[model samples]
Target: MGNKNTIIWIIVVVIIIILGVVVVGNRKAQAPANVQNQTQEESTAEEESLPNNEVLPIGNNQSEGSANTDTQVSSTAIVTYTDEGFSPSTLEIKLGDSVMFVNESSGGMWVASGPHPTHTLLPSFDQKKTVQTGGTYTYTFTQAGEWPFHNHVKSSEFGKVIVK
Candidate 1:
């Protein structure tokens, strides 16, 4: 009887240990998923509050275009997309300025370089070129016109870089 009781006690202890191991393993598996969710939420928040155009300082210890000998310095502008659609959908700049379209969306997007229904600006622009997440496309405008562009993948997302 003593031997039987000892065996039963050992079995119960083993069962408890197995249950503990299963619980710990399940928690370990869930930890990564929880961390991923938190990271995604933080990213979304940051995207919402991001500025429309991030102006980089031109040179060392000098304001933008201050040290340049030529007064006709090129300007850089960044266009970003958000939940409310393209931030600053209408961007005005000089004729010789350049604009950079940065795709921060999780999916693909494109910058159709021209007016809708008659896209004459970028005739060679591939309509199906997919700009995946965290991609950038630069376009220089040397002419004065209203160049309308939109995300071909998502038509509702539209913007224009007006070169004057």
Candidate 2:
């Protein structure tokens, strides 16, 4: 009878050990997923904190024909979009200058380089995303030419930028 009791205790101890190992293994497997979720949450928080019209510059800083040859300067040009259409339907800017497209209309605006449907003209100039009302997307003119762009949401609304 004593041996039977001892055997029972040993089985119980073995079961407890197995459960501990299983719990630890499961936690280990889920650790990476938890970390990934935390990173995504942090990224979303950062993007949300930024203002809708935040000016984010993208491209090289060097500009041609500056007063200070050693120093580089870039300028920003604003083109506001309204219900009627782009306020400045035509704009002229120099290379390395950035143009900020602000959406002032009631709906979202998708700024993309035109000949509609396919934004193959100056593909890099496309915003590739929808700019909500009051939001803005800035693109630096790198190449010199007459680049036409339009609101993908309302293709009828169009504009042009002549870069020198």
Which candidate leads the pack in TM-score? 2
Instruction: Give the alpha carbon lDDT tens digit for every residue of 1-164 in model 1.
Output: 99999999999999999999998888987897788888888877666544322322323325534745233677878888654567679999886677887888877877776555355666533254767878777777877888788877777788888888
Ten contiguous residues with the weakest lDDT in model 2: 55-64
- Model 1 lDDT-worst window of ten: 52-61
Best by lDDT: 2
lDDT of 2 by residue, 39-116 (tens): 888777776755332433211222333443432466889999999899799999888888999999998889999878
| lDDT of candidate 1 at residue 77, scale 0 to 100 | 84
Error of 2 at 159 (Å): 0.4
TM-scores for all candidates? 0.51, 0.58
User: How many clashes in each structure?
Assistant: 0, 0
lDDT of each: 0.73, 0.85
